[model samples]
Each structure stands twice: as C-alpha cells, then as structure tokens.
Target: MDVPIKATPKQFYDVFCNKTHYVSNVCPDKVKSVVLQEGNWGTEGSIISWTYAF
Candidate 1:
C-alpha cells in the first residue's frame, strides 16, 4: 500500500525512530497500542511490543 503524506522523508523517519510509542495514534485502526517491553525507547537493544487492532 502506498499512502502519501505531507511530511518529508526525514520527518517520517523521525516518527518511527524517535517517536515509536506514538505510532498507534497515527494509525489507530491498524495498531491498537505500542508498549516498551524492555530497555528504553529509541535505545539500542530495546524491545517493544505491539498490539494490532486486526
């Protein structure tokens, strides 16, 4: 699926890299929630858990 957005490539990358926890808010229908399971967000070796709405 190719969904176009107004954001620049760097800005879009920042969302996934720096603000992963807020991704669920971007696509609430597809992503139910995002949790930091281990370590810290944006850190190397960190683990995250995602719950999908589907």
Candidate 2:
C-alpha cells in the first residue's frame, strides 16, 4: 500500500498512545472487544496486534 506523502505519518504511526481518552468503552464496563496496549515507543523491534471476531 502506498501512504500519502503529505499524511501525518509520525502521529498517525502511533497506536493511540498519546490520546487515550478519545477511546470509547468496549462494553460500557462489561465485555470488551478492541484492546490497546503500550509497549516501546517508535517502530524499533516493536509489534502491535489487532484482532476481531465475526
């Protein structure tokens, strides 16, 4: 995939680490689906996992 050259790659590269409040609840305090976890900053030997069930 080709990313837009003028896009905010630096900020967009983040996994919502800077802003967490904007994230909504998964199940209103019960069951949840999406998850966000923090690891190391930047893309140096770091990995992010995303999963969903259908």
Candidate 3:
C-alpha cells in the first residue's frame, strides 16, 4: 500500500480534539465508548485513553 495520503491542518486538529480516527481506525468488532468525567468539551491537560478488545 504505497498510497500517498495526507491530512489537512483542520483534520489533524479534529482528531486531536475528538478521537474520530481512533474509533474509525479500530476493527469493526471492537467495543467503544466515551465517558464524560467533568470535561467532555476538552480542556487544558485533559486525558483521553482508549482500550480495544474482541
């Protein structure tokens, strides 16, 4: 797969803010969810961790 692909600045920013790529990149059988612990809109030093299993 030598396809040349790139993400624009806006695209990169969206991925950073929201894990759009994280969910889409994972397998279809994987489980996913988003927990809101006081800061769902993101903030300074907000932490986001993801776990994948089948």
> Over the full model, what C-alpha lDDT does candidate 3 score relative to the true structure?
0.53
Over 1-54, each residue of candidate 1 has an lDDT whose tens digit, in order, gives 799887899988988997899889888999999999999888889999999976
Candidate 1 total steric clashes: 0
List the candidate numbers ranked by lDDT, top first.
1, 3, 2
- Candidate 3 lDDT, 1-54, residue by residue in tens: 353437787876776576543543543356364444444545655555555565
Instruction: Give the Cα lDDT of each candidate.
Output: 0.89, 0.40, 0.53
Q: Tens digits of per-residue lDDT for model 2 on 1-54?
A: 563543376654442454322223332343223334545434344454444343
Off by over 4 Å in 3: 1-9, 18-28, 45-51
Each model's TM-score?
0.84, 0.23, 0.34
What are the RMSD figures for all models against the true structure?
Answer: 1.2, 8.1, 4.7
Model 3 weakest lDDT span, ten residues long: 19-28
Model 3 error, position 10 (Å): 2.6
Off by over 4 Å in 2: 1-39, 52-54
Please give the distance, in angstroms, between residue 41's alpha carbon in candidate 1 and its true position after superposition.
1.1
* Candidate 3 colliding pairs: none
